[model samples]
Target chain A: MRIIRYSEAINEALHQLLASNKKVFLIGQGVTSPWYVGTTTVGLIDRFGPHRVFDTPVSENAVTGLGVGAALTGMRPIVVHPRMDFMYYAMDQIANQAANWHYMFGGQMSVPITIWGIINRGGEQGAQHSQALQAIFAHIPGLKVVMPSTPYDVKGLLVASVEDDNPVIFIDDRWLYNYEGDVPEELYSIKIGKGIVRRKGKDVTIVATSYMVYKAIEAGKDLEKEGVDVEIIDLRTVKPMDKQLLYNSVKKTKRLVIADASWKTCGIGAEISATIAESKLLTTLKAPIIRITLPDAPAPASSVLEQAYYPESKDIVLAVENLLKYSCDNNEKCDY
Target chain B: MYKKKSVNTDIPLKTLREMYLTMLRIRKFEETVASLILKKEIQTPCHLYIGQEAIATGVCTSLRKSDYVFSTHRSHGHYIAKGGDLKKLMAELYCRETGCSYGRGGSMHIADPDIGLPGSSAIVAGTIPLAVGVAYSFFLQKKDNVSVAFFGDGAVGEGVFYESLNLAALKKLPVLFVCENNLFSTHMPISACLANIDIKKTAETFCIPTARVDGNDVQSVYKTAKKMIENARKNKGPAFIECMTYRWYGHVGPNLDIDKGLRSKEELDYWMKRDPIKKLERQMIQQKILTIAKKKVIEEMIKKEIDEAIAFKNKSHSPEKIDIARSVFKEE
Candidate 1:
């Protein structure tokens, strides 16, 4: 195992995929430049000539369409968008063309393409740059949405995304890029549509994604000190979400809290909460399904206001502590 | 009798006849589709390629099975000319299970990967950059296959089209940009919409070899397409062909007057005189290349084929609701 930052892990995964597969190439604006916003594609152009690592003009719609076209014709194109907000410009290509091509063509064609973007509420970037739109993409049926938090998870999930035959939106939180974790030096890939239990416990199930996974882990550590055991499930892929795993966990723990960095309205947290409510686990709840999410307003430009806009470890811990207190006070053999 | 130009005598009479037949097939198919729309049998908005058959047939003639082709709203002709199965295409139009897109993609979105026709988009100027990307793939693989993009004069106004053309020319990739200049985009005429109506001149601005042809003349379209295609195959870079054609029907559906009238009766009549299928039939008869009896036999054969296609489409099932979640992400 080697310690590396989240961005370096993605870079290593890309390097391995490119070195192994001759058909794999990179495309997008600033992808070939060392000053890539995420710094995930640094030194890629030097290793693999300019042809393999192309820098497209700032035509998001056209470039994304080009990536789809290339992928259909048997090239694995990794398109990098600097920020997730700019993806709206190419939504037609992503949602209409890339996602629907396979099903629309009756499985006659497959787009082995990956669209990577730096997401989450970055400091002082204002409303445009600092927003997590994973739920919006998750609403689309044809796309696979992956948001990996740790360096290990990023490396493994990215390698799998590149090799997969579908169009994947691999989201990287800008704030999590510098966060370091132990990653395997050998090439490996994590299975798509599977959630991992970061910390296994028996009392409550805390579901989180992207940067919120780390916050959940931190919250779980605090809960452990008070003898309130927590099971943390990191949902790497949000679209083909590991529904079975979530259901099984909810059934076991009976209580649930979702820590999502995105807004509350129709977010992935809402979907998970709904899924739990629809499942047999609804009878097993000890308290109402709790969600620690960002405010429904646009991210503020001020650093202090932006901090309040995003959910943090303290927010997640407080929500969990409240649930634990309610369970203890009502002690009727806690159904949830 | 019109004299047949033998610019490339090496191209066999049989090859020319085949090109003519392909164009006729598209023309007849569109006519049948139009009648179906008029009778209310087909429900979707149909963009008839009645007058622009030669452009599709001509460019598709030069493409191999390995080559990729992208098309636009006026795409039935391109799809059929590029070897798409008539039965599947009919099924798609009928919104049946046997459709190329399994009834999910209607009139404007028929795609058959087996024949190298990926798909067509309803959005104007959408397929230009896609074709360029496909060509770029061929360049990367060091393959001789060229990608063909079929669009209308309206596409020139789109920024993506200009960006794609610039990139294709800069990369010197194997691409054939076929502009079927039908003089109008929907109700607006090219002259009214564009500053420069000359598509070939616009292509020349990017240093791409440009050719202008009478789109009604199938032979002229075929000859120019062959030259441009050969040039691309030799890695001589991209070439642009502008076929000055006209759409017989209105922009959408069979009704000619459903929308606002843009073309005069005199203009329509003058263009009808140069009908591509009728012109080819006349040439074949005058030259004794195809006897009247033989022409009847060919018509009967095509009619039978179309009838069988309609029957197959009628028998095909509609898509299941459970299939909605499938194929979004490719399973390994």
Candidate 2:
């Protein structure tokens, strides 16, 4: 295993994919530039040449459609949307064309394409720049949405996405690019719809994704001191969620708290909460499910307020503590 | 203006007959669709290609089955000319389950991948970039196939058109951008809307070889399309062809009313004198290659085929409401 930053891990996966497959190519704005905003695509053009790793005009919609068209014609295209917020401009191409081409064509075509968007609640980047809209894409039926919180998972999941026959929306949190984790040195891939158990406990199950996964791990460590053991599930793939793993964990613990960085309303947290409620686990719950997410509003511009707006380890812990207090006050016992 | 070049009388009579058959098919299909719309049988807005059949027929005749073609909103002529099944197209327009797109795509989005006519988008200039991408794929695969994007003069103002042209030229991809300059974009004339009405000059700015032809003349349009497609197949890169044409009906449906008073009666009469279908028939008769009785027999045969297609569409089922959510994603 090699310790590397999340961005480096992604770069390694891309380089490996390109080296292995001659049909694979990359296109996006500023992709061939020296500055490389995310630093994940560095040295790609130098190695692959401009024909394969090239820069497209600022026309996001056209470029995205071009990627989809190329993918349909037997090419594996990896399109980079510099910032996730700018994806709105190309939503028609992504949602209507790339996502629906295969099924719409009666399974006669396959779009082996990967769209990587740098997203997260970036500090001080006001309302427009700092949106975690993974839930919006997850709601779409034809798309595969994945967000990896660790460098190891990023590399494995990215390789899997590139190899997948369907279009995969691989979102990378800008805040996690510099975060370091141990990744394998050999070529490997993680399954598309599996979750990793970060920490195992019996009291409460905390399901998290992306940046929230890190916070959940930290909160699990802190809660161990108070004897409130927590089971943390890092949901790597948001769309084809690991419902079996989550349901099994929740069935055992009989308590749940979801931590997501996106807005609370209609968010992934809400979907997970609803899923648990609608399942047989509803009767097994000792207390109502809790969700810790960003406030229901555009992220504020102020740095201090922005920090307050995003969910953190403290928020997860507080939500867990509240659920526990409610169970105790109601004289309920954990039942499975 | 340059002197009119003598007609290529040496071309085989069989090729001219095929072109005539294609145009007649498109014209008959549009007429049938217009009648259906008027009878309240087909509900969707129908864009008739009554006068512009020559453009679709002539351009598509030069393309191969492996080559790709993209079309705009006024796409019925394109669909039929590109060898789309009349029964399936009629079924699609009627929202039948057996339609080309399973009734999901109506008149504006008829697509048949088996013949390499992937699909037509309602968005103006939307398929320009897509055509370039398809051309790029052929280039990457080292194939001789060329991709054609058919749009109208209205699409020239779209930024995507310019961007796609530049990219195709820079990459030297095998693409033929066919602009059917039908003089109007949904009732607005080109002169009133565009600052520069010259499409060939604009294409030349991107260093792409270009040609301008009378879209109403089937032979002229077919010859130009043939040359451009041949050049592209030879790895000579992209070319742009501006086919000057006109739509005989309203922008959306079958109506003779010329809105905005942009088209004069005299101009319409002058173009009618150069009707492609009549011109081809006259040439065929004068050369003693086709008799009037033979032409009648061909028309009657086409009418019967169209009637059977209409019956097939009428008997087809409508898509179920539950199937709406099925084709949005690939499950496996």
Candidate 3:
């Protein structure tokens, strides 16, 4: 294993794919410029040549559809949408064409296209640039939505997505880019619809995704010091969720708290909450589930307001503490 | 001004007959669809390719079976001309299990990647970028395959059209953008939509080579498409062809759309004078290469094919419920 930042891990994965496969190519607005896509696409053009690593114009919809077209014609294309929020411009291609092309053509064709969308949260980026629109993508039936938090999973999931025989939406949050983690030097893949337990305990279950996984881990540390053990499940893939892992974890700890970066209403948190509720765990619930998410509104631009807009470790801690407090109160009063 | 090519004496007679037969087949297939819809044999909304058959036939004839074509909602002509299975296309419109898309994509999303027609879409200006991508793939592979995007004049108003043109030119990819300028966008005429209606000018502004031809004249469309496609395969970059044409049927369904007061009968009659099939027949007769008996024989053969396709569609079954869950991904 090699220690690397999340961005470098992704860069290594792409570099490996380009070097190993002649059929693979990269297309995006600033694939050659590190300033736009950062170190993730650095030195790609220099290594693989121009025909493979192409820097394109600011035509998101067309570029995305171009990626789909290339993928359809026996090419593995990793098309980058530098900002996840702006990807809505290319939603028609992503949702309608890329997602539905295989199914629409009776499964005779497959789009081996990996659409990489980066989530830029905070930085005074305002409403347009800061959205984590994973829910919008997850809602689409034909799309496979994956959100990788760690440096290792970032490389693994991206490779898995590229190898998958369908159009996969690989979403990454930039807030997790600079963070360091131990990633493998050899090429490997983590399955698309799997999750892992970051820190396991029995007091309460904390299911978090994307960058929110880091915040939930921090919250788990705080609770650990407070004698309340918190279990953290880093949900790597949002769409084909690891339901069995989550259900079994929830079965062990009846109290649940979900942390997500998207809107509170109709978000992944709500989906998880609903999934747990519909399962056999509903009868064993000690208290109502809590969700730590952004307020249901556009992100404010002000630094202070932005602080309030995004949920942090304190918010996760508070949600978990509140759920524990309610359960503890019920146990103390013998209110079974 | 676009220079019109004269009837070159160099081309083979068999090729000319094949192109003529393709246009007639499109006409007959659409006519069969019209009667099927009228008789309630098929239920999905269909945008026919009656008068505009020449453009599709001409453009597709210029392409190799290895080349790709991404088409619009009015795609029956494109599907047939590009060598898509007539039986599968008819079954698709009928929403049967044996359909090309297995009833998932009614008339709009017909596709046959085996024959280089990857797919078509109902959304206006949808497949334009897909074509550019296909061309980009050829550029990456360093191959000679050309990709074509066929859309109506109304689709030119879409932002994607300009974006696709810009990218295709900037990259100098092997792509051909064919805008069938049928003079109308649903109910509104093109004049009402765009302040300046020079369709080729926008593409030319992007430094891409542009051509405007009489869409109803099969020879003119065929000549321009072949040249541009050849230029694209030689890595001369992308080219845009604007074909002046008309849709005989309404924007959708079996009836004529002119009764909605969007267009006058006089305009329709004027365009009908430039009928592509008649123009091809006149040329063939003038050259004394094809007699009326031969033309009738060709028409009869096409009718039999259309009749067999309709029968196949009628006999096929609807997909079972489990099939719906299957095609969502490859793993299924």
In candidate 3, which residue pairs get closer than 3 Å at backbone N, Cα or C atoms, i.e. clash?
A: B250-B257
DockQ scores of all models, one per candidate: 0.61, 0.44, 0.70
Per-residue alpha-carbon lDDT of candidate 3 for residues A152-234, written as tens digits (9 for 90 to 100): 99999999999998888999988888999999899999999999999989989999998989999888888888998988999
**TM-score for each prediction?**
0.93, 0.91, 0.97
Model 1: CA > 4 A from native: A328-336, B1-11, B190-205, B258-263, B282-291, B320-328
- TM-scores of chain B alone in all candidate structures, in the order given: 0.95, 0.95, 0.96
lDDT per residue, candidate 2, A128-208, as tens digits?
Answer: 888888988888768999999999999999998888889999998988988998999887999998998999999999999
Docking class of 2: acceptable
Q: Across residues B216-308, which tens digit of lDDT does each residue of candidate 1 receive?
A: 877788888888888888999999998998888888998665235577877888888888888877877776777888877877878887999
Best by TM-score: 3
Best by lDDT: 3
Instruction: Please provide TM-scores computed only on chain A for all of the candidate models, following their numbering.
Output: 0.95, 0.96, 0.97
